[model samples]
Target chain A: MRVLGIDPGLTRCGVGVVDGAVGRTLTLVAAGAVRTPADEELPARLLGVEQGIEQWLDDYRPDAVAVERVFAQHNVRTVMGTAQAGAIAVVCAARRGLPVALHTPSEVKAAITGSGRADKAQVGAMVARILRLDGPPRPADAADAVALAICHLWRGSAQAHLARARQEFARRIETARQAHGL
Target chain B: MRVLGIDPGLTRCGVGVVDGAVGRTLTLVAAGAVRTPADEELPARLLGVEQGIEQWLDDYRPDAVAVERVFAQHNVRTVMGTAQAGAIAVVCAARRGLPVALHTPSEVKAAITGSGRADKAQVGAMVARILRLDGPPRPADAADAVALAICHLWRGSAQAHLARARQEFARRIETARQAHGL
Candidate 1:
């Protein structure tokens, strides 16, 4: 399955695409960011974000989307920006009929660097090593996007397994109920 | 001066332009909304918002922009949409070199209805009365935008007065210090 991961922001958004089956190796397809001029009006900037996402969707066409969950903090401005970015990601995925999943920062870090508290530099270094890149992803947002994608790839398989188990259990229970003639 | 008031949202954004001066009457110049398909990709919707705002800016060329300030809320999804809308408005104003002011919901309601706790219908009715319109502004969001603009006009003048007072006070203090040689 091809999965697209996004780190959303009003001024700058980082995106990464990966392709692989559950419990198997995944390959990076493409990655980039959509940035708008800080001086531009809100509507124009929103258009830039829309145009950028459309371009990526058409080019990559990933099967699923993964985004980072917004965390509450003291900085109202920062929180607001993060929330906007998250909404944009959700709307984009919903429009495309792609299932979207949200992962926490710590979950992404743990999946990538074997530690939930791993710093950005550490996560970036690990991503570089795993993806076997020449250097770290520029602009921490981009690296984080990649890490988020990897986390989904790992956790998604486990989730799928649990879902299958639940289905099997339900089927057995139904069979037992029928046998009891109740 | 012409002031454009914007009520930002994910699916639809309401925009209203009004003509006013420091002491002159305010008149509605134009009002409308920019909407996007909910099923489209987030990026595409953002592009629509950008283009819509650009078209409005080109057509109206308002003197200033007034937008609602987003406060923290419990619903993550709702807050996300609000933040995105707010960011787009800010970016739009900044791009055109138009001064932008933000007002809280309570402030706008108080300005229009003489009470901050006024409901949407109440606020809309008051806005229509204040502007002497034949009917209320349809699609509550549009009326809200107009009310927000009115609030800015009133509060903006008050702010100007306060600023002048501060300047005069500072000047008096400087003159006194100089005369006393302290």
Candidate 2:
């Protein structure tokens, strides 16, 4: 399945699309950054980001979306913006009825570089190597987005399968219990 | 002018609409909470918030929107959710070409009550008095939303006027410069 990954930020949001599934060779479809002027008003800036993501979603039409899950940052302002941007992406995907997955930064790095502690450059190099490109995607944000897509393609599918299986198991048990009239 | 205030939260988003100006007696047109199940997935929860805010905007058609600005919290998860929910409100208003204002919690409290450090109960009491209600709005979140609306009506109008004055000044300056032919 095709996956679109988003590294959400107010000033510079990263988006990448990849075609692949677990145990399959992933192919890069698109990668870029959505930029909004820092000097612009917050609402306008967010609108720009929202419009850009919508454009990407409309163009790429990915099967699933993966967004970076924001955690606390020492800089609360930055963290707030990041979380807001990520949340918009989530809403966008949900509106389209697409399943959305959130991957932590460490999880993305580990999935792409075999180490959760991998540095930016290391992860970038690995992304390039795995995608069989001449070099890493331009701009660190784009590379990070690509890494997020790769991580979700590699790891998220299994998690989704597990969740579905658990739900199905519960449903079967409930049916059996009802049959027993409990 | 009519103002819609939003106190955004993942589980319980508060929304209120008021009609008044800074020097006028504000009337509460509507006040309530948009609740999402805590057990829902993050994307679904955010979707609920987005839709709720959109519905409020559509129903009230307020001239402006005011959202409670989220700050750093000891609970990072809660803060993230709040920020995301607030962002959606901003986006919804911006999409409608409505001006949006953000007031910090302390700012809202100070505007409604006499003190920035006022407790929720005090703020609630003050909101009820200012709105001339028999009692404070039910559910602390709803009161907070009312507080946000009152705060914006109290302060945002002046800011808007100032901005308009500045724009008019710039326009006159530009016209004079053009008349000088250089």
Which structure among the candidates has the greatest lDDT? Answer: 2
**DockQ scores for all predicted structures:** 0.19, 0.60
lDDT of 2 by residue, B1-182 (tens): 99999999999998989999756688999999999999999999988998888888889999989998888764887898898898888999999999998899999988888689999999999999998999999888999998999999989777878998999999999999999986
TM-score of chain A of 1: 0.86
Mark the regions of model 2 whose C-alpha exceeds 4 Å error after superposition.
A157-182, B157-182
lDDT for each residue of candidate 2 in A1-182, tens digit (9 for 90 to 100): 99999999999999999998766788999999999999999899989999999999999999999999898864877898898899888999999999999999999998998899999999999999999999989778989999999999989767878998999999999999999998
Candidate maximizing TM-score: 2
Provide the overall lDDT of each model, using Cα atoms, as 2-decimal numbers.
0.79, 0.91
Name model 1 segments beyond 4 Å from true.
A1-6, A9-78, A85-126, A133-142, A148-182, B165-182
Q: What is the lDDT of residue A66 in candidate 1?
A: 93
True lDDT of residue A115, candidate 2: 95
